[model samples]
Target: MLMEKVAEILREASAEAVEPRFRALASGEVMEKAPGEVVTVADREAEAIISRRLRELLPVPVVGEEAVSADPALARALLSEPAAWLVDPVDGTSNFVAGHPDFAVMASLVRAGRTVAAWIWQPTTGTAYAAELGAGAWRNDSPLSRAGAGGDPEKWRGVLKTRFLDPATQHRLQTGARVFGEVTPGRSAAGMEYPMITDDELDFILYWRTLPWDHSPGGLLVTEAGGVCARLDGTPYQPEPPGGPDGLLVAADPATWERVRGALA
Candidate 1:
C-alpha cells in the first residue's frame, strides 16, 4: 500500500521536477559544501519540491541531506524514530551541479528501523524504479522478470551493479571477463557502471550507498524487481546505523550477485 502509493507520488513529482532543473544547470547558481562537495540552486529547488510532495503524500517525518543536521550523531538520533522517511532530494548532487544527468531523486520509508519501501526517480531520463517489502520491483509500468542462465557471458545479462572504485580497483575489473563502461559525469545517466538489463540493454538500476535516501529507494527497487540487495560486506542495510559510513554494494540478480561478490572477495 505505502510502496505503490509512494512510487506513484515520486513518478508524478519527478515528471514535474526533472525538466526545469535539467535546463537550469548550465545557468544555475552553484555553492560549495566541502572540498569535493558542491550544490546548486537546482538542488535546493528540487529538494523543496520533493520534500513538499513527500510531506503531502505521507505524514511521517522526513530527514534529508540538505535540510537536516550534518552531524552523524544528530542524524542517527533523528532517524532513530520508530517510523520516518529518508530522502536524498538529489543523490548525485555533484553530477547535477556539473550539468550531468546521472543524479536522482531518492526516497525511502523506514519503519521500526527497517526500510519497508523505496523509490528512485531519474528526473532527466523520465525513469522511475520502485519496490516494497514483499512486492517485486518495477520500472515504469513493467514488472522485472528474472533472466535465466546462458552459456555466453554476453548473453548473461541481468540486474547490474554500480560501485565507486579507485583507479586500482578499476584496473582489477578490466582484467576480468566482465563488460562495463565508465559512467560519464554529466547528463541523466542511469545504470552507470551497473545497469538493470532488459532487452539486451541496461535500463532499470538501483545504486547502493550508505546514504539512507540513496540506498533505501534502490534497495526497494531491487527487492521489488525480484532481486536481492545488501552491503558489500553482506549486511542488511539500515538507515540508522550506529556509526556513519556510506559505502554499499548491490546486485540485481542472486546468481550474478554471488559471482560478483566472490570475484570482489
Candidate 2:
C-alpha cells in the first residue's frame, strides 16, 4: 500500500508541478544552483508538493534535493534519522529545461540507512517505475527484470558518467572504458538510466557521484529487477552514512557489475 501511495504522490507531484512547466519554463524559472548544477521552478514546486505529501504519509524527514541545496545540513538526516524520504523532484532538470523527455521525478524511502522502497515517475511517458526492497521492481503494473544475456566486457554496451570525477580519475576512467565495445557519456539522468538498464537498453552505467536522491530510487529499482546497484568497491549502496568513495556502478546483473567494475573501478 505504501508503494502505491508513494507512486501516487510521485504522479501527483509531476502532474501538479512538473508537466505543465515541461518546456514552458520562464526566464526566471531556471537557475544554476551550483557551478554546473541546474534547478528549475518545477524542481522546487514539485519538491515542495512531494515533501509535504511524504511527511503526511509517513511523517519522516523529507530530504529533498532542493531542500538540501538550500540547507546542506538537512542531508545528515539520512544518516541520523530512523527513517526518511529522499526526493529528487526533477532528476533531469537540465533535460526538463531543454524540453527533453528524459527527465523524471524520483523518491525513495530510507530506513536505518537503507532504501526500502522507491518510485520514479516519468511525466513524458506517463510511466511509473517502482520497487520494494524484496518485493521486486515494476514498470507501471508489470514486473520488470533485466532482459538480456551478459557477455564479454569488450562486447558490453553502456555509459560512463565521469563528469564529477577529478581530472586524473576522469582520464583513467576514460582510458579504462576503451575495453567496452560501445560506450557513451550518457544522458545525465539516473531516473532514465536505471529503467534503461532494467529493460536491457544498456548493459551498465558507471557513475562518479552518488547523491542519495539521484541514485537511491533507481538503485533499488535496478537491484529489485535482478540487476546490481553498488558502490564501485562492491559495497552495498545506502542512502545514509553519506560520503563514501566517489564511484557507483549499476549493471544488468552481478557478472556484468563485476566485469564493469574490473574495467572501470
Candidate 3:
C-alpha cells in the first residue's frame, strides 16, 4: 500500500530534515516567510527532500505547500488528476521555526477527488500515522480502532475538530457540555492526533483550517481508524470536488460530531 512506503520515506526525510534545522535554529537562525508567517531553512530543505523522494517512488505530480500557489483553478485541476500527491513537507512550519516541537510531514494520495491513502509523520516525536482505503489506520505498527467502540462519545477519551470559534461559540459549548478544548503543539501533529486521540480513548477534537496537505491525510486516517470526518456543516470531505470550499470538521464519534455541530450552529 502507498501508506506504508510513504510512511517510511516520511520518517526518514523528517528526521534528516528536521534534526539539522532544529540544531541550526538552536544556534541562532531567524525564521520568517511571509510578512506574518514564519519559516525556517528547515522548511525548504524538508520540502526538497520530500519532493525528491516522492517523485522517485511514485513519479506522479505533487502539490506541496511551499511550491503551490493559492490558485483555486490549479488546485482543482491537480485534485482532479487521476493520481496526485498533496504534500505538506513541514506542516506547522511556524512552530518548527519557533523551536516548537509540533510540526509534521503530511501527504495524501488523491484519486478522482477522493483520498485513497494518507500518511502523517511527527518529526520531533518520531510518530507516524497512516491509512489506506479499506485497509484500516495505524500509528507506528499499532492499528487504530474507532473511539468508544460504536460511536459513543461518552466512551471516548478525547475529540478533535476546528478551533475557529468566536466568544459566543465558546460560551454555547460551555453551556451545553463539559467538553474540554486542547490545542495540539502543531497543526500537522494536531491533525494526526485527531484520530489518534480517539484511539487513545479521547472523546473529540476540533480544527479550523483544512489545508489540502494537512487534512487530507489526517482525514483518511480517521476514516480508516473507524471514525468519521466531515466539514463543519456535516458534509462529507471531498479533496478534489469540482467546486467547493476548503475547510474541514472532524469528530471521533457521530454523537460528538452532532454535538459539536450544534454548538457551532
Scored by TM-score, the top model is 2
Please, what are the lDDT tens digits per residue for candidate 3 over residues 1-265?
4566788888787778777776467543554545766666666677778878888888877777766633445465455568877887777776676667777888888888788888888767777788888988888879888754344334434433325457775566445444334423224455446545445545455555566776788788887886778887778776752234644556666766676566545
Q: TM-scores of the models, in the given order?
A: 0.74, 0.95, 0.81
lDDT of 1 at 250: 50
lDDT value, residue 147 of candidate 3: 50
* Model 1 segments more than 4 A misplaced: 1-5, 8-18, 26-28, 69-74, 77-79, 148-209, 241-247
Candidate 1 weakest lDDT stretch, 10 residues: 180-189
Clashing pairs in 2: none
Which regions of candidate 2 deviate over 4 angstroms?
none
lDDT of 2 by residue, 98-136 (tens): 888999999999999999999999888888999999999
Q: Which runs of model 3 end up more than 4 angstroms from their true locations?
A: 26-31, 69-74, 149-192, 240-247
**What TM-score, to 2 decimals, does candidate 3 have?**
0.81
Using lDDT as the measure, what is the rank order of every candidate, best first? Answer: 2, 3, 1
- Cα lDDT tens digits, model 1, 58-135, are 777777766663444535633557777777766777676666777777777788878777777777677776666776
Per-model C-alpha lDDT, please? 0.58, 0.88, 0.67
How many clashes does the backbone of model 1 have? 10
